[model samples]
Target: MFVAAEIKKNTYYDSVYLMRITKEIEKTEGVIDVLVGMGTELNKELVSSLSMMTKEIESLGPNDFFVVAKIKREEIMGVVTKKIDSLMNEKKKNNVKEHSPATLDSALKYNPEINFALISLPGEYAIEEAKKALEKNLHVMLFSDNISVEKEIELKLFAKQKGLLMMGPDCGTAIINGIPLAFANEVSRGNIGIISASGTGAQEVSVLIDKLGSGISQLIGTGGRDLKDEIGGITMIQAIEALEKDENTKIIVLISKPPSENVAEKIFKMLNNSKKNYVVNFIGSESKNVSNSKTHFAYSLEETAKMAVELANKSTVRNKEVDAKCKKAIEELKAKEKEAIASAKNMVGNLSVQRKYMRGLFTGGTLALEAMNILRGRGMEVYSNLAGDERFILSNANDSYRNACVDLGDDVFTRGRPHPMIEPSIRNERLIKEIRDEDVLVILMDCVLGYGSHENPAGEIANTLNLAKKDMTNEENDSPIIVVSIIGTNKDPQNLKESIIDLENAGAIVVFSTAQATRIVAEITKSIGEC
Candidate 1:
């Protein structure tokens, strides 16, 4: 075997593009492994771990682009380098054909009517660009994460003063003016408007609403930090005010992780005064009744969508009638829960006692949190990399503990690399490792589809899942149950039906919602405990 390294000083490409190139290069004959990325510390470490790092790579700075590969022979090094060059040329040709602008000024000059800026950059460099966009009176959706809380507050306050919507520094999903942006789905247009701090949470609800024959008016995302006490839900408050005044939006749905008490109270007070009906899902928060007759508190994303759809369908109804609809929705959810538990029992046949733990490898952080919360609610002590409680935090984000749901999209896993959502293959290695663990009874995952997410995400992981199942069969070990929840719609670019067929064909038990998938895992765990 031989190692080949190439460093291009001052050359840079989008992380997602680099990841795609890496995937394509890896398919070349005689190529053992490859890492293609900017020379960030994390990427260097990753190359070292793969035993492909060299002194030249070590000397490259963050601004430099590098490719390190382990190959079968020296001759294959030429083949690999040519592949990388061809891919880079292909991107350049596409860029030329598209006539893409290189800067905000040029973009505005190209189209003066633009009112929205979707910024995705490294956090260190994102704030200035965001500030520039806000200064231009543009609505900004900042996709970059890792920005300081202080910087976030500064940007939000500026946008608020200007009466502009500042969606996120880390926001990933939104559907504005009937167009899907960033990581969002294509659902029908209707009377329900969603404001969420959780990206995947919003996607789950939006898709579910569509599945229930309802649709979305708008889906606004307030980057995850907007609801923190320090931020005081600035973007969320602005979103609510905008929705309240929107004639098209009659039912408002809010989704987020439980917020700080003061922030929650602020939100509650606003909801109390709203003339339109609302559904609130402070995911994993204790169930509590709101003082307002028009408000419904939901415990899950599914419930949030159901209640919103119910209210939208019965907009003319008042207090008692609305309450009755919500009650019926909750009852329907309970029935589904019971059915999930029954299905879980039948699926856990002849399982060995040693296979006792549930392991979740997720690309969506919010989805991971929801699963952890469900498992914890059911008396399981779930550990996670995204855990708010230190007691449940994983000591090493790379390794899973007794009952773990890991958000592989977390910064620890994504630094200097493309997000798992953009490159689903990032989770493949971890899934294989988990499948080999004898203690893992069940594996839970999510396949998020839409613009800006990987195309055919389910197909990317199917081979890994299939090989694992085959190996388990050959060894006569009960294969760990694999549960996948797809958060998408039929209208998405990635055909939803085909994605499900790929997973099902690979021996995965595929569900439509994250809540149901986690509940199924929780039920399977409960059965194991009883045994």
Candidate 2:
């Protein structure tokens, strides 16, 4: 199907040689591939000259053709033909546009109303651009990580003073007037409003409500630091106050990983005093469920959404059964500690949990903080990621925490490898290894599903879990129990449901929200024993 020819003339440039080869091939029949080689009869210099010219000839067409210099004639022929075919196939796959950094920057000038600048540039250039956007009175949605929390707070304060919304220094998702923006889910709108300190927390809440055939009045992302000691819910408090004053909003949702007791108290006080209905989902903390009118306490995102939806419809909370069932689930978890530890990593949302007492690795900052919060709230001693310590410390864990209602877009995680949404194969081994020891019990994660998610995340999870099960069994132990808060649509991709079934079969109890998942696992682990 292909032919190789040796060109010996000194006048032959690769381009000319290719041209000659094509003409020759045209004269021949049944030849699909063409390769030109310079044999021993040709001088090395002439062969070298022909090499450059051959590319032009191939571009014109030979079915596929290649010319190589310096290498042996047969070797050159093989290399050229293979390269040509590969190049052709590559062209067919993705017509990637290669542009210099300057070209990309120039293109930015075209989008003016994009007042909210979301900078995901490397840290070196992000601050300067943020300053530029701020100077231009543009709202900023910062997706840049590695920027210091201090810088983030300063920028947020500056934006606030300027009467503009500055979403994040590591903000990955948001919603505007019920429309899913950035790394967000497609959900409709209603009277419910949200302010989240965790990037995906707001996304999960808003999207869940949206999927339930409702919508949001507003969803403001407070970055992850809004509830931290330094920030103290500055933006969140203001946003809640504003939403409370707005006539369109009937229900409000507060979603965060977890906050300090002092910060939590302030927020609780604010919500307790609000005239509008409010639902709170602090990922790992189980504060007193608000008993009076106008406010409700939800341990999970799904519960919060369910309550919000009910409030929108002027209905009261009628799910005492769900809470009781969740409590019973926690007891079942307590009975399965060793088995859970064998197959998965441990996670904590609160910071008061004794990291040293546990022998597992952690992944979510908020979840870790909540675990610590739970322990401290219950009058137990705990350690935190602060003090710049070597062990039990991480800065950006929430960035990777799985929230079913958010999509972090195809940015950092999707560039060159498999995204978390697509099944984290690379992340699985680490998860299994970290949890394989005798002290770990829980694998905490937020599972989000929607248009941009993997079709079979649950199925993929099950497969990974099955592999982990084999690993655990080989080590003479049972698989770890996985507690997941799954956020997505019953109407999402068909595989989403299948994935849930797969995860269930693989021994994961997948719930409806990260907050709920965290609460269930925490109560379950404490009851069962250290999972």
Candidate 3:
């Protein structure tokens, strides 16, 4: 193997753009892997981890732009470099033809009508940029992660004082006034408003609501850390207040991992005081009754969306009628579960005794957590990087233990690469690795489609899935059953129907909801006596 490095002193590009360039350059025939970024400490560590680090890379300052590639031949280095240069030139040409402002101040100056800023810089620089936007009386959505909790609290409080929405330090999804923003799906505009701390969690529910023949009014995102003890659900509380007064919102939905007990109490009090009916799904939380008549608790994202749709369609009816509708929704969900179990039984005929473990490679962290919770609830000893219980946490995230589910979108996997959402190909290697493992019985995943997500997520993995399955068959090992849940709508940039067709053609069992996919995997594991 050959490793090549190139440095451009003082040159800078946003991480997203760099990731895009990296993805494009990696398509070169001889390239095995690539990293493109500014020379930050984290980037240096990432290069080292990939064994692509060099003395030149070690000497680079943070301002220096670098591209490093591992390739099959030394001659391929020129091809990789030329590809990088071509991509950079293409971006520059596009920028020249468009009104691409380099900084927030310049952007606001060029267009004073801009009232919202989506900040996606490195964490060290994002806080200041977000504060500047908030000071300019603009709503802020901080897309960068690696931010400290203290910084998040500070930003949320300042935005609150300014009476502007501060969405996240790592917030990834939102739809405002019918426009989809980073990692969000397009749905009909209606009366259901959402405030979610989980990006893909929100996407799943919104897509499900659209599928159920209902729609959304607004979808607000509070970054995942907002509900912790220190931050105390600052952004969530503000979002709830906004939705409460929103005339178009007749039903509200809240999604998150279980909040701190104190934070949960505060959120419940606000929900109780609101006039609109609400459903709360703290994904993975035990479903329990709340004191408010208008409040409903859901155990899963599917149930949350269904209950919200029920309330939205029957908002004018009396409490008794609404109760009856919710009960019917629950009954319907139970019926679907029975069908899923039956389907799993039929599918398990292909499984061999060696096929006893389930491996989940998820791009969505929230979705990954939900899968782990569901599997554990079904009495499966699931290990994961996102596992909340120490005993269930995987010691090495890159290696799968018995019945392991990994969130590939976690920072560990995304340090110097695009999010699996942005570059669905990031999960390709991991997917193939799991496929080659003979002990794996089931492989579960999510295809999240939306405005800012990969154009054809399912297509991106289809070839890998095809090749891996063929290899397993050639080796005479039973290929693990691949189950995928697509979180998308027909209106998304990616054609939902085509995406589903591609996965099915690639031999994956395509489902619509993440919960349904998890349930199917659990049933298969149970049939094999592994759970």
Candidate 4:
């Protein structure tokens, strides 16, 4: 906010106290606060008067306010549009690549038992890739996004015709047999069969179930955005039918974000008629009437998985047993949520072990899915969608992914302009904001290190930490940032540990391996749950 007055030999050009007037500005609709920062000798008296007048005008009426200070509409609009254009470009860049095929021939030459082809290519190219895989008789876990309704229906139908299971086009996550695939959390093998519309929703819940010593029959992802307007629950409809018919599936679990009210009614009706014991989590959706044999409603992904595990292990619950079990777990969980919040706060400064939230900002579809299984065993959430956007996994802004690298054809991690791990400066603000909002509770992160690499990731993270520290308001619980730099001893920079320590000093918890860091989070989460 600036006010300028041209002085010509004391020939007073029409004078107004802009600053004083700004101060007198009234609280009006859509305005949160008004601040004035600049004033000069040429217009000191005028500025002072206007500042006072700003405070005065506020008292006049609801909308009345001193209006001497203003910026050119063109300038403001220009800056805003420029920002928007930059963001749009970033988004476009995120989805710019064509579909990539996996380098599976090499994989096959070495590992003949590799029975799975996790298809994560773009929708346009998915059918072709899937056709080739099905010809090879490989089971596919499709994790691609932007798949058309027609394509998905056709592919699923084709897969069925070939006696194969095609997991998803916009699949969130899935675990098959003993393997956690796609954006899935690690879980033990058991009898609960999960069919979910939300990816992270399914992964988190499934992992919870796994952590409880119970296992899964199969955890299936139906793809997020499946129940939208034109789509009309095609995947869910087919999925529920399939799960109901699956002989190995003793108990059925279904999870989704809030669906349209009308769609909810239809889905619930379908569930009501089903014979299997069920746990449902329509996150942010209403709890509807459940009738017939057995049905349970869970509010969150975590709770949904927990509910599924309990149901899976305990069979033929008597009325008395059901009543007692419900009462106990509900009370216990409420207490746990409180303690978890406290534990997260307490864990801030205690750097006994390195913990990380390893987000594989990967372009490689197969690698991302493979990584998910690896991370899942260690209890870290893996997130990436077919469209290359993981809101729950990555930042919301487009620019944050400007440097991200991926290959649609092969689904491999490729480097982009501003690589997220190397240029933490690009993402720290959003990461800090997410932490403040409690959207994440990560202490450290795992970053890949290979051929073409940034010179100093630890140093980059250190600088990012310094910038974040300057911006943070509530420094008490500034989340413990960490990074697990995955490098072989051969590629180790001479000062790797020292560089990591620099990040530690600037406010980061650095580590060496993704596995080790993930274990820490799992252990911590387990501890929190026990508390």
C-alpha root-mean-square deviation, each candidate: 3.5, 13.9, 3.2, 19.4
lDDT of 1 by residue, 1-531 (tens): 999887789997777888888888889999887889888787788888888889999988878998888889999988888888898888878775566887888989999999999989878778999999999889999998889999999999999999999999899999998999999999989889999999999999998888776789999999998899999999999999999999999999999998988899899999888899999998888745369989998887877888888888888455575456556656675676576567557668766678889999999888898888888888899889996889989999999999999999988888666788888766998999998888888899999999989888989878888877776654465767888888888999999999988988887878777888988898888877731
lDDT per residue as tens, model 2, 471-512: 644435443456765666554553456767777787786665
- What's the C-alpha lDDT at position 56 in model 3? 96
Regions more than 4 Å wrong, model 3: 1-3, 29-33, 48-59, 70-75, 287-289, 316-343, 473-477
What are the per-residue Cα lDDT tens digits for candidate 3 across 1-531?
A: 988898999998877788788768877898898888899998899899999999999999888999999999999988887887888788878785667887888998999999999888888988999999999999988988889988999999999999999999899999999888888988988789999999999999999888776789999999999999999999999999999999999999999999999999888888778788999999887655368889999888888898998888787555565456556656765676576567566767866678889999999998998888888888889999995889988999999999999999887787666788888766999999998888988899999988888778899878898887676544464677888988988988899999988998987887777888998998888877767
| Ranked candidates (lDDT, high to low) | 3, 1, 2, 4
Which prediction has more favorable lDDT, 2 or 3?
A: 3
TM-score of 2: 0.58
In terms of lDDT, the poorest run of 10 residues in model 2 is 398-407
Span of 10 residues, lowest total lDDT, candidate 3:
317-326
User: Against the true structure, candidate 3 has what lDDT?
Assistant: 0.87
Cα miss at 120, model 3 (Å)?
0.9
Relative to the true structure, how large is the alpha-carbon lDDT of every model?
Answer: 0.87, 0.56, 0.87, 0.51
On the 0 to 100 scale, the lDDT of residue 456 in model 2 is 56
Given candidate 4, what's the lDDT at residue 432?
Answer: 52
TM-score pick, better of 1 and 3? 3
